[model samples]
Target chain A: MKKIINEPGKFVDEMVQGILLAHPGALRTVGDDLRILARADAPVSGKVGIVTGGGSGHLPLFKGYVGPGLCSAVAIGNVFSSPSSQQVFEATKAVDGGAGVLYLYGNYGGDVLNFDLACDLAELEDIETRTVLGRDDVASQPRERADDRRGVAGIFFAYKAAGAAAERGDSLDEVARIAEDVVVNTATMGIGISPTILPTTGKASFDLPDGEMEIGIGIHGEPGIHRGPLETADQIADRLVGAIIDDLSLADGDRVAVLVNGLGATPLEELYVLYRRVDEVLRGRGVEIERTYVGEYATSLEMAGASVSVLRLDDARLELLNAPAQSPFFREVSA
Target chain B: MRTADLNVVARRALADLVGYADELRDLDQALGDGDLGVTISLGAGAVIEALEQLPEDATAAELAKACAKAFANANPSTMAALVAGGLLAGSKTLVDSTEPNQADAARFVRAAGDNIALRGKTQLGDKTILDAIMPAADALEAGSDPVAALDAAVVGAERAVADTKALQSRRGRASWLQERSIGLQDPGATAFLRLLQCWQAALHAAPAERN
Candidate 1:
């Protein structure tokens, strides 16, 4: 309930305005309605444009990923709500190069329906569009129904692979293929120690009793698989990483990329603590950690929790993962 | 009713939706992100404004299209988009018809329900708006008079809304709750019922008011 804002209704508008001001050189609003955010150098003639969008509250997600070597544009929506089909269509028009546009986003119903409608509209305008859904949250659904799983922090991998492919002037088909590959190879699981408060409602999205934690919790405060008394940090790490690892069926000598993502309020120190245990567990299983990311890559307002995402990697995915990319929230400085 | 009468009905339906904003928000808070009320209210307000500006001679399809566009522009929520999609699908069925009857209404409802299911990738038992809308469409298709058809539709939707309490969510935000989502009425289904009830009220009131 205690946060800095003038009006709950205008929160998204004010926040987007601030983002534009803060990153004038890198980002700009597209269309008369100003609902789509495109990179300053969008529509880079021959490259396949990459677009992603979702609800607003998850900062540094759809919008933060809009920049060079990442997403070309993002359709902005209200907090925890999908962007309208018209807004998504505007994003498609703003980012369409001759090669076509790739829609990479989570597999939420609203997002899917709206984006699909936008695609139909875009096709009428002679712009080709392809979609790759992210369903990497292992906790949302069982492996047999993986397509029903929610897209969580692991979407970062899809963004990286697809963006890198497009940056290298790959065809739209190749970019979408690479993005889907990342989705298929990645698995994410999270645990929540507390719930986040919705800005407008000024109430917790859900309640978690003090001194307890919920495993397999979704970023939107969706119910998790199990809830019990809080356990040790290592135990929590084991549960999260263990779930992902088991889902991926990773074996010895397998190389992987690790993402220890904080769900907004969790601190870097705590994320590292979880990462240390994750690294130890993976090493014990002889899984090679090719790269690791530890930060708030994806968030749920100020929810206090973290998620562990593991992407089973091959040489192609590893190369894409290491490729140079720059965005306001994420960056991989070429080494 | 003619297209002009449809506009009045549309305006009344939107007003009724705005009135239910708080109730819908409370229902959504139980399992959803708790923004459905505000989002739908904003969409309904925009549609009302659009209805006021619509040309007197606008056709049935034109009116439906305007409502869809207005709703899409005002809010980007899931439920709003689904409603917009339904409107668009329903509008397609009303093309070439200046005056719509009970049969046209039945076709519109059926098309809208089908579009929502196809776009949402959900089925009848998914505990979504389709639960209410699908049965309402079937009831409308079976009835004769427009008012009577709408009455049946409302009854069907009311039953669907009650039935949602026993179902598990398979789509949208509530899907995240898993088994915990049971026992709570699906907010989207409840909203669908409210829309049907509002439309039926407007239809029944129009004749009396005109007389």
Candidate 2:
């Protein structure tokens, strides 16, 4: 029930205003409604545009990924809600260069509907678009039903690959293919020991006993697969990395990138603690760790937990991952 | 029917359908945020005014487009925008037609229904507005006479609304309720049914239909 804010209703708008004010050169509002934001120098002539969005409260998630060599635009919505189709269309229109646009976003019901509607609207304006959903949360659905799994931290890998492809002037179809490939190779699983308090309600997003943790937790506090007494850091890492390994079927000599992400309230030291165990488990299995990123890449407000995302790397994906990229919340300098 | 008179038919039907706005609001209250009634009432009023301003020689496609623009501008709700987009997509099937016949009515309704399904990421049994629309579209295409087609459409849509009562919602806010949403009449499906019945009544009273 305790938090810092001016008004609950103004939380999203104020946060967006702060971001716009803080990163004026890197971003610009696309539409008059203030719901859509695009790269400051968008419509890079002949480069395919990549538009990614979802609900708010997952800051540095949707809106934070808009800049050079990342998402070209974003349509932001309320906390844990889908943006309107018009907002999405506005973003598409603002960023579309001569090449077509790609809709890279999470797999959720409302977002899917709104984006598809925007695609239809974009067609009316002669702006071609392709879509690739981030369905990498292996805990939400089985590997066989990956298409239906909810997107989680693993989407960062997709954004990186797709954005780099677009910057290199890949055809719209090629960019889309690359995004879909990254999604296929990625898998994420999270655990939640604490829940977030929504700004409006000032109440918990979910309830759990004090000494227990929820495994396979969604960012929005959607019920995880199981609830059990809190385990040691190594055990937690084993559960998360173990599930990802089985899902992606990593074998000896397989190259992969690891992301140990904090779910809002967790600290950097704790993330590194988790990463320590992650490194041991992967190396023990003879998996070659090509890259390692540990931080709060995506978050669920003030929820206290972390997730692990593994992207099996090939030469092309590794190249995309290393390409020069910059966003407000993420960046990748030249090799 | 004369394409020029399409606006009049639409305006009259919309005005009549406004009578059920309160019922729609009540139904939506049980499932969603309860703005369906307000969206429809405001949208119908806006469309009525917009149709009044259309030129006497306006084509049916233009009329449909006007309805789409007016309805979308009437409210900021995602539902209104989606329905408006559906109307715009349906208008494409009328590309160069001067008059809209019974067949055109079937085509328009079915095209709109298909767009709503695809745009809404749903199918015939998703417990959204499409549940009522596709059944009505099928009936319209099956019937030979306009009057009979509308009658059959009404019956099909009514049956669909009743049948959907036992199914859980699969889209939009109602889906969040999971199994608890079952047994409630979907406000969206009901709204489409109301529109069909109003159109049927308006057509029956039209002087052009009599001729």
Predicted model with the maximum DockQ: 2
Which runs in model 1 stand beyond 4 Å of their true positions? A32-34, B1-117, B120-211
- Residue-level lDDT tens digits of model 2 in A239-330: 99999999999999999999999999999999999999999999999999999999988899999999999999999999999998998889
lDDT digits (tens) for residues B38-116 of candidate 1: 8889989998898899988998988887887777668765566667777888988998788998889889988988878
Pairs with backbone N, CA or C atoms under 3 Å apart (clashes), candidate 1: none
Q: How close is candidate 2 to the true structure, as a TM-score?
A: 0.85
Candidate 2 residues lying further than 4 Å off, grouped into runs, are B1-38, B41-70, B88-101, B118-128, B154-211
Q: Each model's TM-score?
A: 0.69, 0.85
**DockQ of candidates 1 onward, in order?**
0.14, 0.37
